[model samples]
Target: MKKTKIIEIKGLCVRYNNISILKDIDLDIEEGAFLAIIGPNGAGKSTLIKAILGLIKGYKGQIRIMGTPLSSFKDWDMIGYVPQKAAHIDRIFPITAYEVVGLGLKRGIRGNNAARYINNVLSRVGMEGYADKKVYNMSGGEQQKIFIAKAIVNNPRILFLDEPTTGVDIKAQDAFYELLKSLNIEGMTIVMVTHDIAIVNKYVRQVACLNKTLIFHGDHDEFCSSQNAIELLMGEHHLIAHRH
Candidate 1:
């Protein structure tokens, strides 16, 4: 049986101040698929994500989620977003790890069940014991895990991460990837924008290459093996040497 499409984008174009950033982009992401969008800097990768998240308002395209038009999906609660940085969070916010995770339940904060959900999400991310610790005191990797816990606290069906593993140590990167794999296994569709080609090739089921255009979107094996994809993402010099 074919999986239902979770995300559908067609003729997507993004522009800023009359300058084009993304042109004629189109993509269809399957339900429960782990997808990675990869490209070199200035490839409009971030712009693409912003467009999908509805952060960029003047985009020209049709975007749909779960068979409903983007405009119709009023309850964004179905989507979980973990930005590249915890931008709004203050280093010394005086909030514990548990409270941070609980923020994920923003829309469901009517009663005590929000706390229970926070605990469950923290445990899933293996940060159960750190619930009482202060966010500012934790290491970078730990902070990232806490953010992930917060993102999933609402049990969203679709999760989007932007440069999730950036600035983390090697060990932390591996652990985070493992955790993402586990989450994917548990049936959450993941859309990640990352520059880590090796990790993307190893784990992502699909790849979408963006650079002011929809260069390619398909199976991971084909993307990793394609000459064009390699050149587009790694640059022509690296691709030539990599193939040789």
Candidate 2:
């Protein structure tokens, strides 16, 4: 079986106030890929995802999504994103999980069918009984689940998550990754940015290391076996560990 490249980038560079954040980077994301982007803070991991998703503008390069240039691409519903710090969503504001997921529903889907779809998405994320639960009252992990449900309720082909498990408990992180794994198994492409190197090997099919530029891009097995890649990650001060 062969996978098609759904995302293609060439000479991608991003800058702010004359300061370069990323430079001359090229990346291709195939359909159904589970890729992990890892780097130190401010290494442009989030910027890269934002750039690819067309959230940030004025970058020097070409990006094509689903074979259409990003400048001409308009099918946003095909892409989903969970931004960093989403776990800390306004604890003081009262909003139910069902309403949260509804935010992602397409304008055309409504009435009973929309209601059932939202509930089904909630169940898929293991937040089934939480459809009516207040996000402010739920645990950090549970709130994260609601956000994921919102991201996926649109039935996007590829999902992007930035630091999805930050500030989550270990137990919750395990469950969260398991949910992501199941989603990937069910044929959803996922691109995630994480500071956790352990997760790079634990769940990702591809590993891309970044630092103002692409330092490495390869399969997880190659990353684990290459001393140069290991040393490069060590320079970033990320703990390197092998998963059994």
Candidate 3:
């Protein structure tokens, strides 16, 4: 039995003003797959995700989420997104961690049910005990976990994370990846955009290298073994057994 495709992109193209951001992009994400989109800065990786999320307008080509065209897909709740650092979060805002996660619950899960749902997600990320903690007091990693809890509080089938470990410490990053791996094992589709090469080789099952177009898209091992990937990502240096 073949796996179902959770996301499908065909001939996708995006432009801002008059310059092209992405051109002729094609990719597929299978159900339960952990896909990492990696590339140098300004490579249109973020643009691709925004296009799929319908955050960008006037994009050419097709994007389908769970077999439904982007324009026709009405199941926004089924998809969850954890943006980098919750970029707009004001550290001094004085909101509780639970309240932050609660914002993800746009509909349903009211009252006790809502609290229970939020608690469950927080617990999954190992931040349950900090439910009442002020967001500003938490470390960068702790705050990132809170963001993850918020993204998953709604029980989304597919989760998208952008630069999830950007400011996290090494220990916190390890724990974070473990949580994500557990979620993927339990049947959640994960699409993460990152510049972290180490985590890419360790956690993601699929790799998609983008530089205004699809440079490579296949298994992790295949990507690691490819000369093109090594050149594009690691520069002129050969990939050593361990990257310091």
Candidate 4:
């Protein structure tokens, strides 16, 4: 049997002040699949993510989340998002890691249950003992893990991460990817926007190479084999690898 598509985008286009940012992009992401979107800066990679998240306006296209039209989809809790690391958070907010994760809980969770849930996710991210530590007192890797724990505290079906490993240490990056892969294996669909092409290829099952458009979308092996993939990555961006 074929897998179900969790996300669908067709004829998608986004423009900013008359300048095209994403042009006629099309993509299909299956349930439980791990997909990585890669491209250089200003390549509209983030724009495409915003469009799928329904954060972009005046776009020309159709987007469906879990087979429902984007505009009509109201199951926000089914999807989770972790934006660029610490983009909207203050390191010195004085909030504990447990408190940060607790904020994403949906209504109705009792205090005891909420704390258990928070600790469970923190443990999943290998921060089991740091629950009481202040957010600012933690290292960058520790902080990123807490942020990820916050995003998944509610048990979302699909998780979207943008530059998730930005400030993480090299060792933590491996552990982080392992954590993501383990989650994917346990049936959580992951869509990540990353610049680390080489690292992503080692984990994600699919790849979507974007540069103001959908240049390539396919399985990891095919993406690694395609000459177009190398050309597109090497053509304008030195950030991506020439070979997987």
Candidate 5:
């Protein structure tokens, strides 16, 4: 069966001070897909995501989310975002997990059941037991999970993450990916900007390589074998052998 395109972009372009950040980008992300956006530093990977989220505007192009034009898309709750390393958050701030997740709730979720719903979201990321603990006391991986819970608490249809695992311990990265995999299985499409090409092959269903333009976008198998991928990745990196 053919999948529906959850996100569609055409002629996407972004500029800063007359310098092109992204140019003529065209891409489509299917429903329920776990897509990894990879590129070198300063290659406009983050800019592309920000543009799609409508966080950074003044660009030229068409962007549609769930079949509606971004400019007309009023259902912001359907989209979840976990920025790079959860940078917007103060790592040492004294805040509980429950409170963090609560901050993401839609305006309608209030009164009696709101607290229960917040706990339920925390449980989704295996942080139910630590809801009372201060976020600053948790490890980097644990903090990441808390932020993820915040993003998902609203039950977003699509989740966008920017370098989510940057500060996480190497050993815990696998577990973190598994959590994201579970969310994808439950029908939340995921689009992540990452530098870890190795994990891209292991966890994500699709890959999009960007370097100020759409370099490549396709299944991992095709990406691994495509001449475009080889040429673009040449001298920069190599796709690691897929591990079971």
Candidate 6:
């Protein structure tokens, strides 16, 4: 059986000040699929994400989520997002990791249920012991995990992460990818924008390459074999791989 598409974009074009960033993008994302949007900087990758999130208006084309037009979905509570860069928070803000996670339950909190939800999310990210620690004192990876917990605390159906592993250590990157994969296995639709082809091949089931254009979108092996991908990444960027 063909899986139902959770996201559909047709003839999508985004422009800023008369400059086109994304051109004629048409794609479909199936439910529970892990899609990695891979491209170099200035690829209009971020613009595409913003368009899907409805953060950018006045774009020409159609975007639909879960069989409904993007504009029609007034309640976006089902979508969870993690930005590319973590914002700087005050060191002395007087907030604990638990409190940070608890913010995800901003809609409503009844009794100790909010606390339990926070604890469960933190435990999922392997930050069970750091719930009481100040956010400033925690390492970058730990802080990222906290943010992940915050994103998933509400049990969103679709999770969008932009460079979730950026600036983290190798071990942390591996663990973070594993966490995302586990969530994907548990029936979460994940759409992530990343420049890491190696990680994308390892963790994501599908890959899409963009460079102000939709170059290719398909399986990992096909992506690696595409001439367009090679020209975009290796030809223009001068990236070389030594094979014995």
TM-score of 6: 0.92
Question: What TM-score fits each model?
Answer: 0.92, 0.95, 0.94, 0.93, 0.94, 0.92
- Return whichever of 1 and 4 wins on TM-score: 4
Q: Cα deviation of 95 in candidate 6 (Å)?
A: 2.9
Native-to-model Cα distance after best TM-score fit, residue 157 in candidate 6, in Å: 1.6
Pairs in steric clash, model 4: none
Question: Residue 221 deviation, candidate 6, in Å?
Answer: 2.1
User: How far off is model 4, as Cα RMSD?
Assistant: 2.1
- Local distance difference test, each candidate: 0.83, 0.88, 0.87, 0.87, 0.87, 0.85
Q: What pairs collide in candidate 2? A: none
Question: For candidate 4, what is the lDDT?
Answer: 0.87
Q: lDDT for model 6, please.
A: 0.85
Once fitted onto the true fold, the runs of candidate 4 whose alpha carbons sit more than 4 angstroms away are: 235-244
Which model, 2 or 6, shows the larger lDDT?
Answer: 2
Worst 10 residues of 4 by lDDT: 235-244
For model 3, how does the per-residue alpha-carbon lDDT over 50-158 read when each residue is reduced to its tens digit?
8989999999999999999999999988899987557356766889999999999868779999988988989989986899998888888888999999888877889
Candidate 3: stretches off by over 4 Å: 236-244
| Superposition TM-score, candidate 5 onto the true structure | 0.94
The residue pairs found clashing in candidate 5 are none
Model 3 per-residue lDDT at 97: 92
Cα displacement (angstroms), candidate 4, residue 10, comes to 0.9
After TM-score superposition, the amount by which residue 63's alpha carbon in candidate 5 deviates from its true location, in angstroms, is 0.4
